[model samples]
Target: MISINDLTFLIGSRALYDEANWHIKPGDRVGLIGANGTGKSTLLKIIVGEYAPTSGTVSMSKDLKIGYLNQDLLSYDSHLPILNVAMEAFERQNQLQKEIDELLKQMETDYSDDILQKLSNKQEEFSALDGYNIEYKTNEVLAGLGFSTEDQLRPLNTFSGGWRMRVMLAKILLQDPDILLLDEPTNHMDLPSIKWLETYLQSFEGAIVIVSHDRYFLDKIVNRIVESRKGKLTSYAGNYSFYLEEKALRSEIQRGEFKNQQAKIKQEERLIERFKAKASKAKMAQSRIKALDKLERVEDVDDDNPTVNFSFKFTKTSGRHVVRLENVTKSYPNVDILDNAEATIEKGDKIALIGANGKGKSTLLRIIAGTETFKGKVETGHNVTTTFFAQHQLESLHLDNSILEELQAFAPKHSDTELRSLLGCFLFTGDDVFKKIRVLSGGEKSRVALAKSLTTDSNFLILDEPTNHLDIQSVNILIQALQQYEGTFISVSHDRYFLDSVANKIWFIEEEKIKEYPGTYAEFEVWNSKRVIPPSKSIPVVPTKKEEKKPVNTNADNKQQLKKLNQDLSKLESLIEELEKAIKEKEAEMADPEIFNNQDKLSLINNAYISDKSALEKAQQDWETLAEEIMNLEA
Candidate 1:
């Protein structure tokens, strides 16, 4: 167990954490959540003892062991194969065994008391650490993380940055420290690998604190949520979904408290004002004034929402068929990644590609974008303009160029005013637009790349891990824009919530094959659940007590109710459209040039504008409610 008491950290004069307290029990599984730069990573470092806190104490049991995994990795030598390097985690165990072997040989040769005693103690320590099963367990973890048998001999240098991180993760898991401090452990992992990690962590005999933006992963793995905000810490019980609901409830309670305090202060002030105006009640007025002076004001809590935003609107539409691949095969020198994989992309299709790490998801994206070659038929649609955003697309930007120059290069024909306005849409202000590309942070670089992509007229977009460094607000904006887009999109991303919001189809790459499903993400989950379960070929299976008590639904009755609701929504949409058209016509008449010159005409137009806007907003809200009902009915 670890305890963080009165912890405070500062960057120059800015306080990142102030007098915050948090503790991790023996079986705690915590998901750390906060906006960018709120010190989630810093807290992890403090817990791991990598950084000394500016103030306060981090107390832990003596002889405690802790492991930390960072996003950036140091170079791992590839001279030895990947498996050999990963197996180094058991070095101590291996050393103990080697000594044990020598001790046994010496015991047979010379019967010295000291040598005999040493051999016995060495064997005992080795057995205590499960030294006999170290190799098997290490290999198991490596394979679970998606390393092929043949890849075990491949040099560590041959692996890419993502694969190197996977190797690091395997080593950390093999170490099995008393506490695991992971910052974005799922960032580079694919679906299968992520699931494997979740299973491993769920059974791990240690406390874990994970800082990640992946909602699905948190929902599956974490049992508690710790939010770092406004230099303070707030704890919530249960998983990410439970945290969301609990945080909302807490905010509601705080809002009610704030309102009540404000009302009380106002009432007291009114009474004091009336008494002060009368000479007869001057003493009472003085007493009331003193009470008012001593009264404590209620400070409203700050809004915790992050202000990250993105607006990506394409200017054209692609052909009916955007891309098609048949009989695709990809392999490295020692291993085959994809075997006879085939996929297709049609216009207006929001597709999400998923699979385990090293399962050819990225390889397939590269093949489609024509960056990597494959033995396959890749036919791009006619008049198709493709915009490919790779995982490290931000690094591909010219560092020498200023942010403004980078946008200008992408859209040279646009005037300065137009370019500046476009930059503003991506959250770049006046001076930020002038900053050098090399000077910006990773999050800023990602935003720049996104803004650059939006300036083009491409109708076909292929993105790989596009939301890596983005905050939640930016993700929402991007999701909204993609929903409004009229072109084709094929993305490989680990952000489950983003995929659920934008993707309409699921393309799974598994077992060296590609599988496609037509429906929303929730529908895909249901299908996947069924597919993963093996059919019963046994003699018999008795029903559980809980299952026997549950009532089976009548499908016929549900279908009739859904059909009726859909019909009603169709009628409401038509009525709202007619009212919107009438309002638009009335507003256009008041905007005439002669009327604009008259003050009275301007006043009339302004009043009409407000009324029309209010009506439109109300109608939109109603339509949204009906749309949700229709979605539920369809589901």
Candidate 2:
């Protein structure tokens, strides 16, 4: 419905878009993706006519209606009831209703044929406009966006900015515009609300352009991916996952073509140099030189995937029992958060605390951090130093201090050089480290806060929505950092990709208690949706008459089986010992100066070592199985 033709936009001296063309046709579910400051949101605004392109046209029909949900909409304030606010989207229906009500009032007093005819006409128009069902549709959208029945009657101004944005989202959804431009819609949404929005968008007839860092949401909603990169819009005819694989393949092809072109250019350069001096070949050389000069060089792909290589500063290891909560009870004025809940956090556990909003996920994090009041026994294990990172803590950052200075103050033991190196892993390097915290953006501040949290000499970490306000790349960096962390942690986040990447266990609050699923977020999602009983649970089967007549074990048979188990265990133990010894000997050879110097010999020895290690593991497993069987027989 919208055509961006040769679009070029400039922010001062920077070209945000250069000859970028994208046609957002009807029913096109386009995911607009890019790193922060790449102008994805700006492109949406240009398409919606809020901003004009510097060089080209964003063409669409005059009849085409566009609904844009953006950060700027958070400034919208109203004292009107939320339902009324949302119902405003049905302007024609509401207007028709007003006329119908006026005609009804007139007919009550006059009851003439003219008045009756007018009333009938107005009622027909109102019915045709679906005025009677507008409120129902509005209420459904509001509820899907997480408004309770009572909340529908509440004033819009009473809601927080995030919730207000949701109200705006409900309004836009009620409009049923020809196209929807959503910029980070999931940022203000909880997982459930996000899911509801996803389902709603799936059946929506109009086109959608979503700029989101939530890869899971993008993968579920977008049928096409339009990546904003290097001042151009590149189209991918698939979702986010497909775009990733396709991009990698294209990058590889581009890399090869670039190398081949470079080699060809070098050959042409040599030929020109060799023949330019000869009178017979000078014309051909000149022609070749002109062709080379006019050649359009392929821009090299800058595929820099920065990873978090910095380590968490550890003063001491936490005990096996990181934290224990016994009979914990926490409540607000009218809401009971957790009542008599018990949970344990053990060392080396990476737990993701997740659920719908107002479920006390953050409150539980604070209770663990010992920063909130509750009726419970919360015991911190020995040497379990904790570092808590939350979005609210971002405000605790010293605005006057530079990014480097903030880190220096938080980690006084570390030198400025070490702090700068740590910040480099968070993507702050050189002059960026000197930027004052006040001048930093939300994402920048989040990176600094995360860097500070990681550098604290604490073995137990508590993070509340740490992935909030961070882009995909920053989230990936955090994921890498958490994956490498050896200590215990409980993080509250709605970012499914982050949770799946960093969490080994999932925790969700249910029935005023903390419930845990010992699996990744993706695994939990599958089991949760299916309510699948794990394979570990035994299914009892009644024995048939034929099965009931099976032979029973006698003393002699049991003794013979026990003896055989013991003999097999002993043999397996001996084999395991021998394999271990052989592996050590191979490793010793690998470490030798002679073998290490010879790559071929080292490869052979390493392969042998790996084989021995695998055999040792199998032998050990067999020994354990045999020993268990022997013990069972004796019992």
Compute each candidate's TM-score over C-alphas.
0.74, 0.81
Which portions of model 1 miss their true places by more than 4 Å? Answer: 72-92, 101-113, 263-313, 326-342, 404-434, 510-514, 532-635
Top candidate by lDDT: 2
Q: Note the Cα lDDT for every prediction shown.
A: 0.77, 0.84
RMSD of each: 24.0, 21.6
**Can you write out model 2's per-residue Cα lDDT over 1-635, one digit (the tens) per residue?**
78889999999999999999999889999999887778988988888788988998888899998899999998999999999999989988878767756765675688798976776676667556766456667767887888876799999999999999999999998898999999989886889999999999999999999999999999999999999988999999999999999999999999998999999999999999999999999999999999999999976778556765556678799889999999999999978899999999988999999988888998999999999999979999999999999887888999999998898888888778778877776668789899999998887888889889987888989998888777787788788888889888999887999999999999988878889999999999988874422121112111111112228877987776667666666777777778888977986785575664344686577656655665665566556555665666686
Residue-wise C-alpha lDDT for candidate 1, range 119-138, written one tens digit per residue: 76886687677664565576
Off by over 4 Å in 2: 272-287, 412-430, 532-635
Compare the candidates by TM-score and give the number of the best one.
Answer: 2
